[model samples]
Target: MSSFAKPGSEEQELKWAWIWFKQFCAFHRRAVEREREFSADEVIAFLRSKRDANVPAWKRMKVIEGLIVFRESVQHRNPADLLPLRETMRGIVSIERAKSEGYDTIDDVVGKIDPKEPDAIQEFRRALRRGGMALRTERTYVGKLKNFMADRGLTCLADFERIGAADVEAHLTDLAVDGNVAPSTQNVSFHSLLKFFTLVLKREMGKIEAIRATKKPMTPTVLGPKEIAGVFEGLSGVHLTIAKL
Candidate 1:
């Protein structure tokens, strides 16, 4: 676990960090010809972009830790190259705190966004990007939020602030009961909305406790050697010719 990391936080950090590293890889792929090396300068630029986009400071730090760990453990490269990014982020974080603008995830946010998000769900997209999530993630999350908003009638001129945990639970529950989505699909939808509400919409998720989608038991298809041979023996005439051909 990382220093000062809460219990189980390191796992969460790695999860979130992988999310960031993917972005780093994407950025690295775009800006350089050879993808053989992880550059601290490139990472610094990526972190700067995240800060500019208003990703929380703690989240960006996790991103750096992920890169460091990746270099040391996965890539078997020197982790020291990323130290500059850590120091640079430290100074920036200090400046943010001195200005009294450091926003903690635990702190309650008291404002709402344009609930409609009529401009192509840009706000949600921005939130995902700022969080250093990947482009595919942005697409999936945006799709999920759009479906949730449209289904729940948040399109236009509706009371969005009143949208709460009950509404979310109802939507997910409907997907399970009515839509008959697989358990994993329902989980994806749940998390998509969870992040949207908590990170993008700045609302508390409270507790999910929604009725989960139960996966039905599946039967395996198998044929014994005798069964296969009998089937082959039965294949005469055109079937046999087609099989041979």
Candidate 2:
């Protein structure tokens, strides 16, 4: 019997598998040409465009999900290159709309953007200082905020206005769960988000507790004598003159 006629046959399974594999390969190649890495924004934009171009929504959604997973793996290994690719993909997607069909490439995309839009990072930094965050705290918070934005495929910190309490919670949860950060570290992230929303975005965060309050077991204390001995042993080359201090 033919493969299509046998529902449980190995040949039938192989045929379906090959079909899916070919589809994935085709989408992957297209994504590669669009940019070196994929991001959530890029996936959404691509799916929207595909839908606009008459592709089925289900197919586009599946392809976008696969692309995101593949791109995230690449990002984990090489984050430095991933950011630019994400920006590039956003530009590409933006320029492909019906109103801007003639535009292509990063230069074209960036060139058309208005120069008057305020720089989000600089603005947020200014806001942070105005909100009385210490210089060191400002730097640390901005770094965390920037990384968070990048992870979520946001182009700027100003985009925090669009983010809700749930999004903030989810990000903090991921940092705790996936990042395996200490409670203190997670609390810092929580404060950073709270500040970004309340101070920079001038919005309120309602009833969200700081992640730091969730304490883990205390780290075991090292015996001081053993620590002192280890340090002293490492000073073997030094001439220790017995000086009465």
- Best-matching candidate per lDDT: 1
- Winning candidate number (TM-score): 1
- The list of candidate 1 runs beyond 4 A from truth reads 1-120, 156-159, 217-220, 237-245
lDDT of 2: 0.56
The runs of at least 3 residues in candidate 2 whose Cα sits more than 4 Å from the true structure, single-residue gaps closed, are 1-118, 209-245
TM-score of each model, in listed order: 0.49, 0.39
User: Per-residue lDDT of 1-245 in model 2, one digit per residue for the tens?
Assistant: 63355556545544443443345546445532323444445445545566678764445544543444344443333334335544554444443441243434434322333345335656666676445444567678878777678767787655666778777777787777777777778777778877777766777876654243354767997658777666566564333322111
Q: What TM-score does prediction 2 earn?
A: 0.39
Cα lDDT tens digits for candidate 1, 1-245: 63575789667756655666678878656542223576778888888888789997777887888888767655677878788878876656544543453233212111233455664366666676456565566668778878888888786324457788888899898999998888988888888888877776677876877889986757798988888778879899999878556
lDDT of all predictions, in order shown?
0.71, 0.56
